[model samples]
Target: MAKEFTDEDDALLAELGVEVETKKEAARTPREERIIAGFEEIQRFVTEHGRPPQHGEDRDIFERLYSVRLDRLRAQPDCLALLQPFDHQGILADAILVPGPDEDISDEELLSQLGVDDIAQNDITELRHVRSTADKRAAEEIANRERCEDFDSFKPLFNAVQKDIDSGVRITRPIRKEAGFLKTDIRSGEFFILGGQVAYVAEVSDFFKAPNGESDARLRVIYSNGTESNLLLRSLQRALYKDETSRRVSEPSAGPLFTGENEDNDLASGTIYVLRSKSDNPIVTAHRDLIHKIGVTGGDVAKRIANAKLDPTFLLADVEVIATYKLFNICRTKLEKIIHRVFDPARLDIQIEDRFGNPVIPREWFLVPLFVINEAVEKIKDSTIIGYMYDPATSRLMRTKDWA
Candidate 1:
């Protein structure tokens, strides 16, 4: 060991033009070291790929892992700052990592987040006791796909969905952590992204409780690549949760009023207009009384709908203004949400392509009779609409039950 330098020795060294060495930073903790190592591996991947790793079922395993690791690093500024010195690729600026984690990411978790599993037993930095065998098998079940013999029947559906997304009828939203109760959203005919592939829930069996007592069901999931898996609903939910870049593909719905984005900014300055579509479509003609377009606008109702036949919202035909309720001091957007929520179950499920051949899901059209609409308006006036929901079976507004 070197002798301790006294103040006299320090002064003598300075006088002799000698420099004393000092530490620039505190010694890194094991966690910080691991974080840095993980990030360096990701940097290596970036160097080899010439692009940052991306999320997709079709991407290479290591690339996917690097992508996930990059995501985690970006989310933690602390991790990013810590990794800055090692960031020779300038990835730190673009979530390439300028961080050190404020977390307890164990070796197993780190490996899992990087989408690594098969090599866990070999002990990556002695990742012992990190993953259990049963859990490993369960995770493997998600990726084990079989040839889909009936994929031919689903091919047209997939093609249609792709078209809808391309035309703005459907949208894909990031599967956020805060998306409450994901399993509830997984129903028959729903689509999701898992392992970077488009997944469709072709069927959902009766719900049963797992060992943990969470609700689960057997799902016949079909993939776009002609493979299928009979995975449990809980498995899909867990996969979605673990995959940071996973997304939920929304169903085709009447897209924009083609104009709600603009009107959403307007305040309490519009009339609640109810109009009837005069389209010759068999269904519209048959149930014309039950289907009405409800909307709010700050401009004249007649002037607003000057060219109804050209607009998809009016069902590509002229409309008759059946009723109009003048409003004062009411936030039109909030009222529209309330109305939609009240009659959500009664919403008319119709998809019409516009002149541009883009799929459009019309908004604000409900299957309620005229008298019910009048009563709903009166409730809005008295602020009693909050306590009611439109009941199509009973043909009236029923008092909403407070489950909470």
Candidate 2:
């Protein structure tokens, strides 16, 4: 008669010297057992597929098979070993957890207290690992998007901006303060700001057609303020170049300098500065122009634009929207498509007239990130893994169950 083993018995047999029977049983009831069972299932699945899964492909498989009771299974050492790679190291400084001296517990005790048998610890650890990896990957991706071939050639501002993106905040173009002066100098680029920190983007050149009865030439702002005082291309270039003395800026110092605005030109009342980058590293310094008016219009629009330019809120929002729609599709693909159609008109209506005689909303075409806070939080609560796999373009997450 074939030997019969209980779940604990099988684990014990596997732990001890028992081989043939335990190995055979491991193949038969892999997915049914707790802890190592998920890993066995994964190994079997990989074997069935003819090879080991490559990097992120394993994560997809782990997310799918474990999603059933992931919160319960991930804490097991055996399960975590199979799911997480040995060589993987966290990039973010905060993710690297080192026990403090104030704590009475030792490292081993701290690890013990985390309840390796419980799923929460593994889930938290795994999430941190994934987040750190995503931060590194996001930096690489953003660089790729910007077509940066040399890391050294990339600007320091780019690194600063990415740091903000990882934290789920908006990036803002950096601004300089003058002693006892209310003057402001704005930096050029698309950015987001969250909670005082700014996610700054490198300035890219784009041309805008002349507005009605405006100049015939295509006006461009190397950087846009998202409101009035959007500088023209020539104007921005002039700001970067040396004026008056006709001598170039010495020792590679870049900063903003205010050029008084002409009220007669219908230009907004503010000072403009020639901001320059001094080092081999690209760092933009904003010289805030002194504004004659304060709180004239509702602060909402200005606040939103400023924040959006500096924080990861935009990226987070995109992630949430994508994940939400994706979950909707997984649950009811057909119905969701219909719903999207119903909502299409409302989205189309949210447009602003542009200088090119076309509709342009900063969120839609200005290449800025749009993050809706509540929606992101909801999506994260719904599916943690899918929430991370958000699509920037559509702001949606793909569902594993839906694919299955």
Model 2: residues with Cα > 4 Å off, grouped in runs: 1-35, 40-150, 158-188, 194-404
List per-prediction Cα lDDT, in the order shown.
0.74, 0.29
Least well predicted 10-residue stretch by lDDT in candidate 2: 287-296
Cα distance off (Å), candidate 1, residue 321: 26
- State the TM-score for model 1: 0.38
lDDT of 2 at 219: 26
Give residue 152's error in model 2 in angstroms: 2.9
Question: What local lDDT does model 2 show for residue 86?
Answer: 23
Can you give the TM-score per candidate against the true fold? 0.38, 0.18
Off by over 4 Å in 1: 1-143, 256-295, 299-404
For candidate 1, give the lDDT of residue 228.
89
Q: Which tens-of-lDDT digit does each residue in 55-112 have in candidate 2?
A: 3221342333333233233333443444454213211111223223321222223324
**True-structure lDDT of candidate 1:** 0.74
